[model samples]
Target: MQQEKMNRSLTLIPVVLFGFSFMALATVFSTYGVAAEISHGMVSGSYLLALIVMLFTAYSYGQMAKAVPSAGSAYAYTQKSISPYVGFMVGWAVLMDYLFIPMVNYLLFGIFFSAAFPAVPSYVWILGMLLLVTIVNVKGIKLATVANAFISLFSLLFILIFIGLSAKDILGGAGTGTIFNLEPFYNPEESFSYVVAGAALLCFSFLGFDSATAFAEETINPKKTIPRAVIIITLVGGAIFMTVSYFAHNVWPDYTTFTNADAASHEIITSVGGKTLASMFLAVYFVTVFGSAMSSQASASRVLFAMGRDGQLPKFFGKLHHKYQTPINNILLISVVSLLSLFLSLTLVASFINFGAFIAFISVNIAVIAYYFIRKKERSFKGTILYLILPSIGAILDLWLLLNLDIHSKVLGSIWFALGLIYLFFLTKGFKQRPPELHLGAAESS
Candidate 1:
């Protein structure tokens, strides 16, 4: 009997929008205060530097996606191009990211909404966000893409409004009283190391670009479309971040003056755009978080489905719903896991996700060199640069960021890695046999 497959209904446009959903444009404001503080008024430069770091890994991901267009993403890429042991470890590590992301958004939503309505319980909002994302995802990727499209459009519109308002205010004797200024990008008083530190933190804002690769099976053309979508998502997301951060830093020249760094965007928005725009920012930001959670949940489920189908976890997880042809089992499991947010704090959840992400980034870059350069022997000068030099830089950068993670993240991440290693030993029966994997003769799609 033939295996059930994903619906190949996604083309370039919807795919891009789906990626946009994950890299929500509004995220610039979400972390603006802390990033601004770290960069010392050079948040835009930090974001620009972060973008350059991510692009190299993004390119490596594109190459791997072209070679192995599997829903498992970094996990599957590492398994095929490098050691299966390493691939399993990569997947296990990134599962920390894919799994916790929705919970992070859910936690944030609950905290924010509950604050506004005081009467409604925060758990209610958290549950609602979870159900909304789960239902949308379970229905199908088609429905999810439609939701993603709408949210993506709204994000773009909101950013444009912000830029327009910020530019107007700056021109009208506000915030340095000029649109063009170097302070937002460079501060002679601030050391460049500060920018790099801020870049390490800001890299989380660009997480969604590679998540595009998770939908390879559902895409119309995995090889061409996924590659282009990954690069485009990175560039577009980076452009939005730099532009937004530039204006925001200029608008509020004194980052230290924020009464509360956590909610600093609220102060800036209300001050510049007034009460109406402030209200609009909150409302639209809520929706953007919803869309992002939905997108991340969907990606997480697909990754689980890929692993289960390969016999790494359990075969039942591989089974798609007969009607929707979607990973309903995995989706539900992720939703259940998200309930942990009720017990977990936002700071702890957010800290460890970046730890897993950068590890996966480093793995992919190294995989490019191992598979293309060493294994395949693509040794021309161009291949050397593309497959070796570029990926080495990417790996080094990823390692630097990984090391920069807070003590909390490093401690938690190390525990998670140790657990995965232990599980790998049992799964392979003391390393005597290979972990189970299913290699399809051809890619599957509708």
Candidate 2:
């Protein structure tokens, strides 16, 4: 078999630009903000805090991505740094994260599409969008990458315009008192514990930063480029999201209004401006969500394909097109799963998928801790505290959120995770034999 290598057409643009559009950004910030509005406010402040946390959290991944440059992201890093079992679990965790997230993105699109044009059933649009994206992804990576870039670029332009128009409206005295109220943080009425739990909801929204690591095999000068992409995408995407949150809060002001509009056209966007501006914003929303859905599908399929090639999944899943060098079978599988997910209730699909993400976040954090200790790479107590202790706390916090998920989502998420565990056991039993390693250095010297 040929060695695993990626075609290096991907640049920082695909890594950064594509996933930052309004549909994705809006869904993330608005969802978190809406939840916070019901539970509390200062979601804008919390978003800023998340950015800060991500900056520090991202540094370790940046270093590791350069050092390893593998396809499966945390799954690859944790395995090399620890053991294959750890790798297997990490892969299982992320497979859910990658799989469900696209479904969430597409479901959100279905919601908005149904709202924008009330004649069509939301589920139809959801399934249709999922099908179209799946077809696009199955064609090839190069095509998907190029499409992501163009769609993201257009989406970015519309978002900027939306923000500008919203800012002007706020300045013109059409804004509400909640726009200036930072009272949510100090308010006696808010539940602090739920707010902490609510932070988990925001966790998945900031996920695209890892796209760099996922695309590592495809990048030229991966060591230099991958780290740069990881850091830049995190900071830049964080900045844009923070700014979008700021504008969204300023325009809608009372976060509760968004939640009240739940499963409907978010009044937050409609409340922003004139029909011309609204039309422009709606157009922006279209591409923004479409890009996020597409990006998620593309990234998730690659992870599945890698695992399959390692004999940890169905053998047919490992097949790639000879000419395109793309994982055709894997992409098709992802597309089918995504379409199935979309046809179900959006809320139902989101419930099942959300915990996969929480578990992933928890698993990766713990893996970083385990890797450090197992390797004894650094012996200092302080280093241990910094890497292991903090991430453990993070993992614990994530698990708490997972546990607290509403009964419906929690039950579904558990079933899905259980299926993954069963699949993992079969793979482990089937491929118990170890493979030999090659040393290019020794061969060259000899």
Candidate 3:
């Protein structure tokens, strides 16, 4: 019997929108206060620094996408460029990223949705979102892309409104009275370590760009389109983050004034646009979270499908729906996992997701070095910088972030990695041979 494959239907616009939605532009509202306090009011600076660091990693991903345009993403790149053992491990690590991100997003959506509509139970909202997204994803990628684009437009609209209101408040002398203030970007009281710590936390907000690679199998002209979408989403999303955070910092320059640091953005919105607009903002924010859950779940299923196809996971995961050309089983698995959000705390979910993301980032950067330098022996100066120097910096920064993760995250992540090793031991039969590989036709459009 022949295996089913995803239809190559996604174009650059939908792919970029999907990436942006996965990043969830409204994250600034949820994280702004903590970021501000950690950076000592230098939220913009921290985001800028994080963006610069992520760009190196993004460049490496672009190169790898060009080389291996498949849905496997980091797993495929690491496996083909390095060792299959390492690839399986990378895939295992990313399970945390792809798997739990949807859970986290859904959890947030439940919390916010319930807060907006107190009569409905949060669990109902969570389960409803999970079911809706699972159905859309199982139907096909094109529908998911269309759904994401619609949600992304609403998110962008809210962001623009917030920015406009913030500028009006500043220029009208209600806040800082000037947009040229450097206080949001630099603070004499902020230590370098503080900014670095904030950057580590902010890394969570920038994770979705690489997720574009997970759709390579379904994306039209993926070799060219995926790389461009990855870079575009990262840069565009980073700019939006920094710009919004800057205005927000200017409006609420004193972190001590916030009643609750985590809720500071809400307070700022109320201050700038009144309670009515704040309510509206919260409603829109919920929409962004819903979109994020959809996008994250879709990406997660694709990664699992890639692994299943390659035999790194059970063959059931590799099976696609004959009619829709979608990975129905993997989509169902993610939906089941997302139900755990009702029982788990958001902080725990966020920590483990970050743990997985940083590990995968580190692995991908190393894959670039191995594939281009050690394996292929590419020696041109441009190649040297692209494959060696940038990736080295990316690896170092990712390691720094990994090491600096909170103790709970480190502990949980360590336990997860240990479990992955045990599974690998059995999967590879005591490391006697390379893991099985699945050939899913030629690489997409390379």
Q: Model 1, stretches more than 4 Å misplaced?
A: 444-446
- Compare candidates 1 and 3 on TM-score and give the better one: 1
lDDT of candidate model 3 versus the reference: 0.86
Q: Mind sharing the TM-score for model 1? A: 0.98
Per-residue lDDT for 126 in model 1?
94
Q: Model 2 misses residue 182 by how many Å? A: 4.8
Assess the local accuracy of residue 166 in candidate 2 as a C-alpha lDDT between 0 and 100.
72
Candidate 2 on 1-446: residue-level lDDT in tens?
55544577766666555445312554543464454554465555555555655555465566556556666777776666666766666677777777777777777777777988999988788777777787777776677777777776665676687677777787777654334555433345665654454455555567777655777666666667777877787777666765666666666656555546352224555677556756766676676677777777777777776676666666676577777877778777777787765457777776766666666566666666666655545448877776676666666766776686788877877787677767666656655743222111211111
Order of quality (lDDT): 1, 3, 2
* Lowest lDDT block of 10, candidate 3: 437-446
lDDT against the true structure, each candidate? 0.88, 0.64, 0.86
TM-score of each: 0.98, 0.84, 0.97
Minimal lDDT window, size 10, model 2: 437-446
Query: Per-residue lDDT of 277-346 in model 3, one digit per residue for the tens?
Result: 7988877777787778888888888888888887788889999888898888988988988889999999
C-alpha RMSD by candidate, in order:
1.7, 4.1, 1.5
